[model samples]
Target: MKILFNKPYKSGNELKYIADSIESGKISGDGIYTKKCHDFLENKFGYNKALLTTSCTDALEMAAILIDVKPGDEVIMPSYTFVSTANAFVLRGAKLVFADSKKDHPGIDEEAIETLITSKTKAIVPVHYAGVACDMDKIMELAKNYDLFVIEDAAQAIDSYYLGKDGLKKPLGSIGHLAAFSFHETKNIISGEGGMLVVNDEKFLKRAEIIREKGTNRSAFFRGEIDKYGWVDVGSSFLPSDIIAAYLYAQLESLEFIQDRRKSIWNRYDNAFRGVLDSKHDITLPFIPSHATNNAHMYYLVCSSIDERKKLLAYLKSNGILAVFHYLSLHESKFFNGKHEGLNLKESDRYTNCLVRLPLFVELGEQEQDFIIKHINEFYKKK
Candidate 1:
């Protein structure tokens, strides 16, 4: 009974679509498959414009570029997120004001964001951790009052929804001025290494295309909007190949099936662990707020302490299960510690040291999952 951390799931048409893309002789970006993908996302999600990128990191970089992030500009984000969330702005010479996570969940604290905003603050990047929504209403109000850009890091938020104060539910990516989503192998939808830049505000559409096409109006040239295209703006080669889009399209077509299974797996884990593990007073399960809809992207538990988490992770691995820990708090990381200004991010640090992710892929079988649950139970029982 050997179970790894993640296994990429394939829809029936992935290879077929990849073959189709190769046969079309335009394996480059924004080909037939690419157009199909763009259409699918825009039509389904109601995003103003969705551009496929080589990776989510590239999409975030593109968002930073679109907003004109410059030196000394401050961007606020959770210290508990992946480096890419901070690195995108850091590459643009912006100062990162690391925010703390909520005590109940790993999402950024909406209450703390207002205090972090200063005269130099330019953007607020709220990461929807584990497909759970952050307090977007508060964050959006703050963004409006302060005139700051909102970039939703929806890397794990696909198929997730956030209910607003107006009682309307909006897709996570659609609410922000700009957003980035990942289709990496580890995510629910995947294309090996692929991503999408969702431009909710239409102002960035044309420029977003130009930036994605290596600072050229190549997208316009291809669309017959212009006779020729050349260097136009500061940008990069962010667009992904049509092959990647093709594979992603196959996955998108079966999005419901993938989400259904993932949610089922997530619910099973929640039901199994909620009362059982939580009753022991040494572990805590994920907490979902009423305003957010779960996409079940991941299932992680917070142990009582760093030592307990490490020992439990070791115990699981020794039993042929590959449970894993998540990100370290970026503020406390060696690269940023000196520059972090020494703000106390207790909740972020707690998640960094204590959180452990269990395997929750689409193909993880009932028996295999049971084995994993049994091992986890055994590990805790002995302690």
Candidate 2:
């Protein structure tokens, strides 16, 4: 049997909700199901406001606009993150100042961010890689000291929490001034290709809705808050269809079950590989900090070198397991390499060459998991 890297899980209510949405004759954006989704996320996470968008990229774009990113403004983020993290700001003509990832984890090094700030610096984006929370307290303090906007690229961090120095646990997206989440098929929850813009700072609350409605106050108009709506700000069509929200709401109803199953799979992989491989193998397992909770987005191993990762990926593929490597250091990419300043982001490049993600999905059976575990061990034994 071929073990795929990811298989989107269904909670059996997606079609039912879709049919209900169709029967309601409001299949456009922000219908009954859409409101349900917004309410669900807002109530569960205590977000100031939550608006569904077509994709996480659109959400990030909305954030860039909310923070008033402009030409010559510099936005600081990790070089190891997905392109959407940088593209959102780049689209607004802002200069991207890429930071390095932590030596222990793929999240951005909060300590390194302060030195990257400049007179034109506008925002600090913290990406919570693999549903693992970054050190929000330090990041937030830096943003406070520098007076920079904090936009969380929380694309993989749903249901994750960060434990603050105050001895309180706060949800990941809630800490940032603004945050974006993805419901792509690979995430814990999915809407095929959907995302949400979470407004944490009430200052951007009204504008966030206006920006989402194609630079108009249509959301307020629909709610009878305004008699007429017109173009008021620079924005785009970022809203997702109600049909997508219908599917996402179904998944939201099963969020607990999904998180539980995914975490179980993640723990199994960690337990099987932790301290079992030889020191010569030079494989580093996933490490969750003491202050973060695991939401089980994906499990990855950091091999000693790019060559080892390539061989392991080939071995997994030859054995019919579709394991894969992740992002390729955006700083070194052809598109942005010329634009990036001459900063040696060693840790970011290390993750780019070495990180390999294994198959971790809710539908993965115990037998299939064991087969994957056995093959990985056997391959390393021969190494």
Candidate 3:
């Protein structure tokens, strides 16, 4: 049987809700279904405000505008993150200052952030890689001292929490000044190609709406808080149709089921590989810090080197299972070669070369997973 790397799962109510949204006659954004999605996210995540967007890239762009990222302003972020994280700021003419990943994990190194901050530094974008929380307390402290804004790239971090110094657990998106979440098919919860921009700072609340609504006070006008909506600030057509929200609401309603199944699949991979492969120095499993919670976004392994990873990937494919590597270090990309100062982002490059993600979707059955596990173990055994 040919196994795919990722297959989007559908909750039973998705079509029914989408049909209901169509019948409502208001298929535009911010209609009943959109309101329900916003309410669900805001209430469930304790975010001050949440606005749905066409995609996570759009949400990040909205965030860049909200923070007033000016030309020549600098934003610090990990080199291992998705292009959307950097492109958002670049679109606003902000210079990207890339940071390295931690030695043990793919998340940004919190200790190295302070060293990168300059007078031009205006914001810090920390991506919660693999739905594992970053060192937020340290990140927040650094931001506070530097008077910088924090935008959580929570594209994979749905239903994840970070334990603060006070021993209280706060949601990942809620901790940042602003956060962007993805609902792409590969993510834990999907709305095809959807995203949400979460506003934690009350100051950006009004502007967030305006930016998502194509630079208008249209949201306030709808609430009768304004006489008529018109141009207000820099914005775009960031909002998604209510039909997308309706489909997302169905997934949100079944969040528990999805989470549980995904977690089980993640654990199954972990348990299958822990003693079998982790004993060798050439391979490493994921490391979860004490302060972070896992949301089972993806399961990846780090091989000894790029050559070994390529062989392993080929092996998986030959066995009718598909495994893939993740992001290339952004600093080394062709687009940033001359722009990015020559800095040794060793960990980011290592992840780019050696990490391989296995299939871990909600619909992946146990037998199929066991077949995957068997082939992986067989490959390693021969190696």
Candidate 4:
């Protein structure tokens, strides 16, 4: 049996919605389907405003623009994240200040953020790695103290919650000043390639829409708030077509079903490996902090060494199961090494070399998962 790392699950209504969008005679950005998507996200997540973008990269770029990232401005974020996180700020000529991952989790180390802040710092980006929440309380406090903006890299954090000290649960994307979410085929909720930007601070609400529509007040014009719209600020055509939103809306309608199944699959992987791998001293399981809710975006394990990870991946591939590794540390990457201040990001490097992701999609059957689990156990036993 051949097993791929990821397979996009269809919610059964994607084509139907897409056809409806095509028949509507207006398949451009912010059409009827697009409005439905924006309403669904805002109402369900309690986000102040939600705008669908062509991709998460676009959403992040919009965020970079909203925060007014200028040359010489510093934006601190984890090194163990996708390049898009840093690239958004980099495109604005902002200096990237790389932070390390947590000792127990792949998410950013909240405790290490303050020291990275300086007079030149303009923003703090906290990535919710693998749908696990970062410590927002500490991060927010730090941002408040320093008067910095917080742009959440929540690409994998849809349907996840962060439990606060006040005993209230806040959605991950709604906590930060601005947040970006991805609907890449690999994620739990997919639209082939789509994303959304959540504007939590009202200050950026109007400007966010303008930036998304190529620096024009078109969104307002569509709402009858303006008679004419034209170039007003630096921006881009970041919004996705209504066709993309139509596909996304179908998935959103089945969000609960998708989330529940994914969580079950995640639990199966966790239970299969937990105590069973206790003897494997070099392996570390996924860790979810008490304050974070699991969205089961993906299941991953961390090997103690790069050699072990490489061997494990090869073994899985040989077994016809295509498990994969993730992310190289950005601070040491060829493009950013010269810009880095030579700080030791050991945890980031550790995750870079050791992390391996397993297959955990909604459609992965019990039999297939059992086969994968059995093979993994067999391989570790022989080690």
Candidate 5:
């Protein structure tokens, strides 16, 4: 069998949508499809405003702008997250205060955040790793006590929901003052290369529009069909091309079915690996919290150490399964290494050294899953 992400889910009528956008002769940003995406997110997530961006990276950058992050300011986020989560603030001249991940999951430990917050701390960026919702309640409580702004890095949480204390499931991006999402090709859904910014606060909504449109009220001008628009604020061209928006709209329309199928594949892996996972102290299953819903973005196993993980990686490769690993713990990377391990980030490094992600694309088949599991079982049994 050929190596693939092993999950199977087509995003949308990508080519057709793009072609339609081209035929419409308005392939610029903020066209029909862009409005559709805005409406889709606003209605689905109860967002006060939704802006399509070139990428989640851009959405995050916009958040940095809206918060007016200044030089020497510090932004707190987990060590085990995609760089974009912190890079946005870093670009705005803010220092990244890398917090450790929770012992149970990749999400940042809320307890650790308080100790990191200081007079120089301007904002907190919480990443919801692997489409699993972070402890937003705890994070929010901390933010409230500190009087800080919460910008959720919801890059993997497009359709995922956070289970609130009231027993209701809230949209992932809707909880934070501002949140970002990805539409990369590898994600559950895609617009080729597009993303979104969902802002809950009306105060920043107007400024966000201008920043997304190169510091102009172009969005308003476009709506007014104005004869001219001038520089209105400090912004950039973060909006995605109209064709990109069209493709994303197609994916959004099929989100329900796409999410359902992805969940099934995730379940398959979870069920198949349960025995091998719990059968030993060395191999561990992904630890998801009770209140969080798995979006099936990935299925990863935790080994005992970095050496064991590397050996397993070699074994999986030799067996023709493209099982992979992730997140080098930005805390320890050559470019980002630091001396102060204040919170005893033993758990963060523990996560980096141990976690092994399995192949989990939407189009992955059952037979392939069985083959992958078979190799995994053999690796464990013989060891």
Candidate 6:
């Protein structure tokens, strides 16, 4: 009866991995298993170079460092993302240009992005929330046309894909010049606390390596390749221990199963709540475009308005379901105000008010799902 995030976290072989790390005596960072995980991601996903980091926030900070963000440099992103999306650039003193979300979802609106660009605009951080692929084609088109750097915040987008003009589906993180991933316990996989940065461009790979190594040329040095690797540049200690990577590797080896299990749960929720799709035009389910194949990261409901959504939240929590809400609009957050004054992000505001995220994880059983659905349906009936 405890439908607590029934996720099958990294229990199997995690202790063994840690034990091995201890025996190896190289448990600090970037060991053999780190290389194995890095190789798996590169070969499996087509990323040119992948660097394991402490968290998605660390990877994002690495991207910000690579971009050399500074005061007056503007980084555009949606107002609906986790604060880490904007905080990464803000740490480097970059100006934030917040854009509205799309008419249908929380992903950034492409039309809105173009309008926000100016000479001071240096980068675009497109967060693919809920593992759903944002309109990458349109975003890429804008990047090329405007000569802007693209940093994809693929925190929830592991197996998700987008169909390009070639008609073949491209992996989510592989397409962007730079992408960040999260392997936090809350995700489909659990590494306890870890993340990665994927570098797509050949030119950026060298700099990325140095940044991950505390601003040194140590990566080359480790290869018996360099004479001396010193404090070569400005960087931070972003790498995670090989112990965490080993656990992540075990979880990744079962990626297909994890994805399949989560997908089944997502379908269950979608089917049980199917009738609510058209219950009222104002209250709708997630509308995914044909081109996007999400990783089943989250399943949420969009209600009629802010107040209606709030009432449902109270009802669900009161019933012990642990249902939660999503991000408050970042543009209106305490940190950044006044800078982007005329930036009225309407869809972001709507999502901030109406979106209610339900729990989704591997091992969410039929009874648990039924109870959740039962409560949800009951609330709608009384409403």
**In model 3, what lDDT does residue 102 have?**
94
| Candidate 4 residue runs with Cα over 4 Å from true position | none
The TM-score that candidate 1 achieves is: 0.99
Q: For model 4, what is the alpha-carbon lDDT of residue 351?
A: 93
Alpha carbon lDDT of residue 188, candidate 2? 94
TM-score each candidate.
Answer: 0.99, 0.99, 0.99, 0.99, 0.96, 0.97
- Model 2 TM-score (2 dp): 0.99
Q: Give candidate 5's total backbone clashes.
A: 10
lDDT of 6 by residue, 1-383 (tens): 55664455654777777788778889878997798889998888888888999999999999998888888899989999999898899899998889899887888887788888899989988988888888888888888988888999999998888888779889888887899999998888769899999999788888899989999999999898898889888888998998898888888888898899899999999998876644644566776788799689999888889898889888887877887789999988877766666457888988889998898988778888999999988887777
Tens-digit lDDT string for candidate 1 (1-383): 79999999988899999999999999988889999999999998899999999999999999999999999999999999999999999999999999999999999999999989999999999999999999899989999999999999999999899999999999889999999999999999999999999998889999999999889999898889999999989888998999999999999999999999999998888888888899985688999999999999999999999999999999998889999999999998899858987479999999999999999999999999999999888888888
- Per-residue lDDT of 75-156 in model 3, one digit per residue for the tens? 9999999999999999999999999999899999999999999999999999999999999999999999999999999999
Lowest summed lDDT over 10 consecutive residues: which window, candidate 2? 277-286
What are the lDDT scores of the predictions, listed in order?
0.94, 0.93, 0.94, 0.93, 0.85, 0.86
Backbone clashes for every candidate come to: 0, 0, 0, 0, 10, 0
The residue pairs found clashing in candidate 4 are: none
Q: State, as a TM-score between 0 and 1, how close model 5 is to the true structure.
A: 0.96
Pairs of colliding residues, candidate 1: none
**Cα lDDT of model 4 by residue, 1-383, tens digit:** 99888989999999999999999999999988999998999999999999999999999999999999999999999999999999999999999999999989988899888889999999999999999999999999999999999999999999999999989999999999999999999988989999999999999999999999999989888899989889998899998999999999999999999999999999999998897675456688998899999999989989879998899899999999999999999999999868899479999999999999999888899999998999888888888
Candidate 5 runs further than 4 Å off = 6-12, 225-227, 339-341
Model 3's number of clashes is: 0
Ten-residue region with minimum lDDT total, candidate 3: 275-284
Model 3 lDDT at residue 235: 88
The alpha-carbon deviation from the true structure for residue 178 of candidate 4, after best TM-score superposition, in angstroms, is 0.4
Q: Which stretches of candidate 1 lie over 4 Å from their true place?
A: none
Better of 2 and 5 by lDDT: 2
lDDT for model 4: 0.93
